[model samples]
Target: MLKSEFAKTFAMLATGLSCVLMAQNTLADAPEHRIINLQAEATREVANDEMQATLYTELNEKDAATLANKINSIVNQAMNTAKSYPKVEIKTGGQNTYPVYNDKQQLVNWRGRAEVILNSQDFKQTSELIAKLQESMQLGNINFEVSAEQRNKVESELYIEASKAFQQRAKLLLAPWGASNYELVNLQLNANANRPMPIYAARDASFKADSIESQNIEAGNSEITVIANGSIQLK
Candidate 1:
C-alpha cells in the first residue's frame, strides 16, 4: 500500500508540471499589445446626375372647401401633365390650409397652398416639363445630386485608394521605428458625399408658355470622399 500511494503522488506531480509548461507556452505565443493608429482619405469630384424640383400653388377663398378643391385640382393637373414623360417621377408634397384673421380677430378667408415635386435624371426633359407646368404653378426650388449608383461606384474606388494610402503611410511611419513588418489589428472605412445647394429662382407670371424658354441647367460637381482608419501592429 505504501508503494501504490507513492506512485499516485508521482503521477500527480507530473501532471501538474505538464500543465505549468503548457501555460507558459501559451503566454509566449500570445500576440504583442503594441499598435499604431492611422487615418487616410481620398476624394473625387464627379458631375451630378439627378435633379429635383418643387412646384407650388397658393390661393385664398372665402370657403375652405373651395380653396382646398382648387389646390387639389391644380395638383391633379400637374400629375396628369407629368405622366406623359415616363422618365420624370412626380409626387405630391405638403398641402396646408389655414384661416386668415383680421384685426378684430374675425376669420376673413381660407388660404391654402399645395406642392408638386419632380425628380429625374434627364435634365432636358425635366426643364421642358417645368416650363410647361409654370403656366399654372410656381417654381419653388431646384436641387442637384449624384445618383446612388454613381456615388456608390465612386466610393468603392475611393475606398481602395484610401486603404492603400493608409498602408503606405503606416509603412513610412514604422520605418523610423525599425518595424519592417506589420499585421492589421483592425480597420474601418467610411464614405461621404456632398450635395449642391438648392437654386431658388421664381418664374415671371406675365410670361406666356409659348414664349418661355427651357431652363439651362448645369449639374455641378459633387465631391465624394472615403476615409480609412485602423490600427497596425509592428512585427
Candidate 2:
C-alpha cells in the first residue's frame, strides 16, 4: 500500500510538470510582435498668392555686338516696366549669343537671346503687368507658388498628427489582441506642395488688349503627407 501511494504521488507531480512545460513552449513559439503601416494627408487651400513668370526675347543682326546691345535694350525696358509695380520683382537671367548656321554650316547671322524672371506676391497685379508687357516682349512661362513659410508650417503640423495616428492604431491593435501596451521599434516621415504649371507663350503675339482677360487663378491647398511604418512588441 505504501509503494502504491508513493507511485500515485509521483505520477501527479509528473503530470503537473508536463502541463507547465507545454504552456511555456506555446508562449515561446508564438511570441507577440506586430507591424502597423499608416499614412496621413493634410491639405488646406490658401490664396493663389504668388506669381512667377519668365520673359524671353531675341534680337538678330549681322554684327554680334550690335545684336547683344539690342537685346540688352529690350531687357532694360522690361526691367523698367517691372519697376513700375511695387509688388513685382525682376531678376536678370542668362543671356546667350550664338551664331546661326546655314545648310553649308557657315555662320549666317548672330542671334542674341535673354531671359528675365519676374516674381510677385500679388497675383492680380502680376497678371495685369504680364499681359501689358507681353505686347512688348516674349512671354516665356508663368507659374504660381505657395510661400516657403506657409509650406513649412503645414508640414510641421501634419507630422505631429501622423505620430498621434500611429500611436492610436497601435493602441487599438493591441487592445484586440488582449495586450495592454506596445513598444515602438522605429519611425520615419516626409511631405510636399502642389502648385500650378507655368504658362508659356510666343514672343510675336501682342499682349495689348481692347479687353484684358484675367486667368482664374486658384492657389489651391498644399498637401502634407506623412507615412508611418514601424514594428512594435505587444505585451
Scored by lDDT, the top model is 1
Residue lDDT tens for model 1, 1-235: 9999999999999999999999999999997766889899999999999999888999999999999889999999999999888899999999899999999999999999999999999887787788788889998888999998899899989999999999898889777878778889899999988778998865653323675463446789899999999999987
What's every prediction's RMSD, in angstroms? 4.8, 6.9
List the candidates' TM-scores in order. 0.82, 0.75
Model 1, runs deviating above 4 Å: 1-32, 203-214
Off by over 4 Å in 2: 1-39, 45-47, 202-210, 213-222
Cα misplacement distance, residue 56 of candidate 1 (Å) = 0.7
| Weakest 10 consecutive residues of candidate 1 by summed lDDT | 205-214
lDDT: worst 10-residue window of model 2? 203-212
Q: How close is candidate 1 to the true structure, as a TM-score?
A: 0.82
